[model samples]
Target: MIVETDGYIDLIQYLTENLPVLSEQQGSKAGTSSYTLRECFEEQLSVQIMSVCQQNDLDQTMRIDIVREADAILYDFEEVLASVLDNHPTLEQEEFVTEFIGLIKNLFDARVKA
Candidate 1:
């Protein structure tokens, strides 16, 4: 769970660093993020993370065998947002929206909080 949490934090950090315009456009701000949940499963399941990132990246210098693994996680994130909501009765629209907004705020904040 900790790694999953850290991965979400890292992904949000990466996004904030790389895609400020998109993040702002999305209108999400952050708490109780499901962002890295998929990454945790990918790490526990197989070695697909590195290839996914490499394939998606525009960098020509990207490594073929990198340690970064979060593609599956990203996929899972989409699933949670899109499909899982329909299946899980306990998940509420407001709760997800709140958490998503919190995550965005966390990214925008200059001082990272504990």
Candidate 2:
């Protein structure tokens, strides 16, 4: 639930296999779309981290450390995803971002339960 490296790899695989392709009718500039996706991810991650910390009754210091670690992991995962998407130009960015956010949320929920 803490999403170690293996869990991150699983997330990447899940996104690759399950993400839906956007229809051609939904047109948007790639840069704007990417920025929107990034913003959504940041916001969702913040909320999820806070929820997890609160549910688990973590102290302030522990919450900060866990958030910091999660952020770092997410940043690294984003970089890896960017590289993969760069190589596979046909994939829809929006779907990937959406799936990634969902995976992160699920991971946080599991961590809280743990």
TM-score of each: 0.23, 0.57
- Candidate 2 ranges beyond 4 A from true positions: 16-35, 83-99
Candidate 1 deviant stretches above 4 angstroms: 1-76, 85-92, 111-114
- Find the candidate with the highest TM-score and give its number: 2
Best by lDDT: 2
Instruction: Give me candidate 2's TM-score against the actual structure.
Output: 0.57
Model 2 root-mean-square deviation: 5.2
